[model samples]
Target chain A: MKLKGVQQTNWIGVGIFVLIVLIFPFVVTQSFLLNHATFTGIYVIVSLGLGLLMGYAGQISLGQAAFYGVGAYATAIMTTTYGLSPWIGLIFSIAIAALLAYIMGYTMARLSGYYLAMATLAFGIIVHSVLVEWRSVTLGASGFYGIPSINIFGYTITQGIPYYYFVWAFAIIGIIICLNIVHSRVGRALRSIHDSEIASSAMGVETGKYKTQIFVLSAIFAGVAGWLFAHMSYSISPSSFTLDASIIFLAMVVLGGSSSVWGAVLGTVLITMIQVTVHTLGEQFTFITSEFEHVVYGLILVLVIIFMPRGLFPTISSWLNNKMSQRSSETQEKKAS
Target chain B: MLEVKNVTKTFGGVVANKDVSFSFEEGQIVGLIGPNGAGKSTMFNMISAIFPPSEGEIIFRKQRIDKMPTNAMAPLGISRTFQNLQVFKNMTVVENVMVGRHIRTKTGTLRAALKLPGTKKEEVSAYDKAMEYIQFVGLQDLYDHLAGNLALGKLRLLELARALATEPKLLLLDEIAAGLNHKETKEMSNLIEKIRNNGTTVFVVEHDMDLVMSICDKIIVLDQGEKIAEGTPREIQSNQRVITAYLGAEVEKNAQ
Candidate 1:
C-alpha cells in the first residue's frame, strides 16, 4: 500500500475521546465546567482552521477574531433585526466571513512574516472599531442582544448540556474535515508552500492561490464558531472580538502544535482550562488577580518558544513514538535470541 | 524539443547572458558547460521561466514560454532541480515527490477536505506514481524517511525523483553532479542516459567534464555570457576558442 501522505488514524484514541465527550455532562453535572467545555469546542473549530493556515500553509493571520465577530454579528443582526431563523443567520454568518476573508487575503497573502501579522492585526482592530462605531447597526458598546437559540426539530439548545452536545458535534465534524485536508495531496502542497513558496510554485502548486484559499477557509471556520457563540450567549459585544482574542486563537494553535488538527483542539482545551482555573482562583483568593491569566499565557508562550518550539502535541507524540519503536525493536531482538 | 533564441539577461549594468542562443531536439542528453559566472544558471532560469530575459524567446515544443510564470512551466511539461536543493525538508521522500504530481492531479482544497471518493482515488494514483519515481531514482528504502534526514547525494536524487514525478517532457538539471563522488556521478550519468532513452529530453549544467563528455549527445560551451561553441564533445574539445576560454591563452600555448 502507498503509505506516503496517508498516515493511519488512531481510531482507538478517537473512540476513547468520543466516549469521554459523551459521558462527561452526565458524570460532572456542573453547569460551569460544561459551559466552559462547550466554549472550548467552539474555539476548537476556529483553531483548527488557524492551524491549517498558520501551521501547515505557513501564512500568519491576526484577524481571525474579526471573522469570528463578523459571523456573530451577521447572525445576530439577521436573526434579531430581520426576524430570521438562527439557521439562516448561521448561513449568512459563514458566507459573509468567507467573502471578507477572500477580499482581504487576495492582497494580504503576498505579504509574509511580521508584515502579514501586522496587516492582519490592523484588520482586526478596524473590524472592532466598526463594530463599536456603527452604533445603529451593531448597537455600539451596549452590545447586540436578543439572538435566539438554535432549534432542531422542536428541541431547543439551551446553554448547558444541549449546547455542549451541539457544539461538540460541530467540533468533531470540523476535526474530520481538517484531518482530511491535512492527509491528502492538498496537505502536501500547503506544507510545501510553508517550507518554500518559490519551490512550491515551481512544483505547480499555485502558492498565492493556495494561501488565499486557506485564509478564507480559516475565516469561515471562525465565522461558524462566532455564530455558535452568539446564539449560545444571546448577546455579544465588540470587546469579545478584540485583537487579544485573535492572539489567543493563534496561541491555542501554537501551544497545541500548529501542524496537527488534534494539536489545535488540545491547545484550545488547555487554554480554556487555564482561563477557567485562573478565574476560579481569582475569585477564591484576593492575591490572585484577573491580570494573572495574561502573565501565565505569556510565560507559557515564552517557554514553548524556547523549549518545545514545534508545540506541545508534536513533541509529546514524537517522544511516544520513540519509546514505542524502541520497545518493538527490543522485543524483536529478544525473539531472535 | 526546446529552442533558445538570442537570449540576453542583464542584471543592472552587468550582462549575465548576452545574445546567446541554442536549440536541441527531443530524446537527447544536452550538456551546458561554462566557467564561473558564465550565465549557465541564468539561461536555465530563463528556459524554466523563473524570470523573463531582457531580450529573448524560449520555445518549448513550439510554444513561446520565456515570459510565462514559473508555475506555468510545470503544466507545459517543464521541470527543473535547483543546484542548492529545494526539496520540502519536513515532508517524507515520497510525499515530496507526490507534491510534484500537483499539476497532474486536479483535486482542489474543498474536495480534499471533504475526502471525496474521487479525490481519494486520485491521491492513491499519485502516491503509486510517486513511489515509482522514487524507485526509479533508487530511493525506495528511504521513501518514508523525512527529506531533512537525507544526505546531500540522496537529497539530489530525491530532487531528481520529484522532478521526474512531474513527468516533464524536458528536464533541466542545474549542477546535479557538483558534489557527488565519482561513483555517484557515474550513476547520475547513467540515469540521464536512461531518462533520455525513456523519451525525456535532458538538459544539464555541469562543471564535471568527464560526466558531461561521456553522457551528453551534444555540448554547448559558454564564456562570459556568450555561446563560445556548440557541437559534439570531441568537436568542442578540439575548438580553440572553447579550450582557450576554459584554460586561458597561456595554458593553451603551454599545452601546444
Candidate 2:
C-alpha cells in the first residue's frame, strides 16, 4: 500500500532532520546565522499550532502574534516588575494568553472564512494598539528590558549555542505534541470539520467546542514561543509583535503545508532563511529598500497560493511518491519480461 | 423506540411538513417514500435534529430531542446519512468512519495531544470498531482510499459505513439507493436488509419504489407535505390514496 511506503519515507526524513538539527549549531558557528536558526526554532513551535488550526481544522486566525506578545509582556511584567520567578512568569504568560484566546474564541469561533479572518485581523490591531497605547503597563513604545534569563537547576542558558539547544528542545516537544494531536481522534475530528462542518457535526463532532479548544491550544503554543523569545532576546518590544509578524507566521504555515506539523518546521526554517537573505541583500545593495521583506512575503504568498496551494511538503512528497511508484512498476515489468 | 409527535416544519411562507406524526419500534426496517418536495427529507432532518420542528416534538427512547443540537443525536443512538452525500471528501474511508466513533470514545483534545496511555488504548479499539463498520458496509478493501476519489455508489456506502460507526439504535438512510445502477441498487437494498436484521431500526427516505417495496417491513408515504398513508408494503401498493399520490386520481380511478 502507498501508506507503508509514505510512512517509511517520512521516518527516513525525520532521521535526516534530526541529524541536521544536531549538527546545525556546530557547522554554522557564526552568531548571525545561528541567531536566525534560534528564532526559527521558536517560530516553529508557534507555526506548528497554526498548522493544526488552519491546515487540519480549516480555521484561520490572523492574531497569533498578539498571543506571542501577550506571553512576552506577561512574563516581562511578572518577573521584572513584580519580582516573581521566571517559572512563575512562564506559567502566567501561558495562562494569560490561553485565557485571552478562550474569551475571544468563545464568540469568534462561530465565524468562518473571510469573516473570521477579518475578526482576527481586528483583534491583532487591537492587541498591537494596547501594546503601544497602554504606556503605564507595557512601557509604551520604548519597550520593556532587563528581563532575567531562564535558570534551570541553578544553570543559566545565556550563550547562543546553549539557548539554541534549549529552544529546539521545546520545539521538538511541541512537534511531538502536535503530531500526537494530528494522529489521534481529536485530529481526525478537526480534519473532518475542515472537510465538511455539517458532516462533522452529523458524525457527532462538537465543531464549536473543538474549534475553541484548538484555538486555546494554538494560543498556548504561541505563548510558549513568546516566553522563549523574551528570554532569548532579553527584551520585549511592541514592534516585534506587530501585524507583520502575524502575517509572517501565517506565511510560514501556508508555505510549509498547513496540515502537517513537520511542514510547519520546514516552512519556519525556509522563511527564516529567506528573511536573513533579504536582510543581507538589503545591506549589500543600498538600492534595496527596508520594506523589501514585505514585498517578498507578499510575492511568496501569492505565488504559493497560485502554484502550490497544498504547500511545498505535500506537493514534493507526492511527486516523489509518483516517481518511486513508476520506477517500481517498470522494475516489475522487467521482471515479468 | 422513536416517535415523531405531530412534527410540523415551515420555511418562511412554505409549510414543508404539516402535522405529520409517525413512530416505529426497534429492529424494524421502516421506509419513508414520497414524491419530490413532499417533505420526506425535511422530516428526516427534524428527526436527526438538523432543525427543530415548528410545532412538534421528537422523542427518542422517551426523551424529548427536538430542541437538541444535531451532534447530540448520535450519542443518543440516532445517526443519519444525507440526501446530498455528506462524506468527508478529504478523509480516507477509515478516517471518515473513525470520526463517527467520536461520541463513542471520550478522549478530550488535551489528553489526545498528550498521547496518554488511555488515549492510545482507546484509539486502537476505535480503529478496530471503525474497521468493523467499514467491512460491514463492504468498504474494507478501499478503507485506505480517500472518500473524494470514490464513485457515487461507493460514496453512498461510505456514508452508510460512517453512520454505522456511530453504533446507532436507529439509522436514517436518505436516498441510499440514488444514482446507483440496477445491480448496485439491489446490493444497497440487501445491505439495508442486513442492517435491519442486525437489529438497527432502519428509517430510510427513498424515491426508489422497488427498493422500498422489497426491503421495508413497513412503509410510510408522504404527499404534499403530509402523511398520505402508512402500512405494510402490500397494503401501501393497493391503497387508493397512495396510488393516487403516485399515479394521479385518474389512474387510481381507472385501476379501481
DockQ, per model, reads 0.74, 0.63
Clashing pairs in 1: none
Off by over 4 Å in 1: A1-8, B253-256
Docking class of 1: medium
RMSD of each candidate? 1.5, 2.0
- Tens digits of per-residue lDDT, candidate 2, A164-189, equal 99999899888878877787788888
Candidate 1 C-alpha lDDT tens digits along A1-337: 3464445456577778788889999998878999999999999999999998888878788988999999999999999989999999999999999998888888876666666677778889999999999999999988887789899999898889989999999988888888878877778888888777777888888877888888889999999999999999988999999988998998898899997778998899999999999999999998889789889888888888899999999999999999999999999999999
Q: Output the lDDT of residue A223, model 1.
A: 95
- Give the top-scoring candidate (lDDT): 1
Off by over 4 Å in 2: A1-12, B250-256
Question: For model 1, how does the per-residue alpha-carbon lDDT over B185-236 read when each residue is reduced to its tens digit?
Answer: 9999889899999999999999999999999999999999999999999999
- Per-residue error at A279 for model 2, in Å? 1.2
Interface CA RMSD, all predictions: 1.4, 2.5
- State each model's CA lDDT, in order: 0.90, 0.87
Which of the numbered candidates is closest to the native, going by highest TM-score? 1
